[model samples]
Target: MIFMYMSHLECPKCGATYDPHKLTQLCACGSPLLVRYDLDKVKANFKKSDLIGA
Candidate 1:
């Protein structure tokens, strides 16, 4: 089993985008940028059984 997570930084206020690999204090418009991830990919790459450690 392998565990990994990929994400991207998105600013809700200014609609700005940033790389998730780097550290950012806030968006250019003075709004907090949060990390977003792909849910469909997560469901495809992993299984519920895997989470149970079976």
Candidate 2:
């Protein structure tokens, strides 16, 4: 089974789009990809106490 909550992917170098639900690696052109979050939704559904401190 795969966890599929991720919404979008943005390239660190060229800012390209990819499927967030799929397994991915650094782009062939040489850059990292970052996962984006819906902050409002996350905040509405979760609280500060729900997370562990570093």
* Positional deviation of residue 6's Cα in model 2 after best superposition, in angstroms: 2.6
Residue pairs clashing in model 1 are: none
**Model 1 RMSD, rounded to 1 decimal:** 3.8
TM-score of each: 0.67, 0.56
Regions of candidate 1 where Cα sits further than 4 Å from its true position: 1-3, 48-54
Best by TM-score: 1
Report the lDDT tens digits of candidate 1 across residue range 1-54.
222454678999988889877878599999999878867678766786587877
Per-model root-mean-square deviation over C-alphas: 3.8, 5.9
How many clashes (backbone N, Cα, C below 3 Å) per candidate? Answer: 0, 0
* True lDDT of residue 35, candidate 1: 76
Model 2: colliding residue pairs:
none
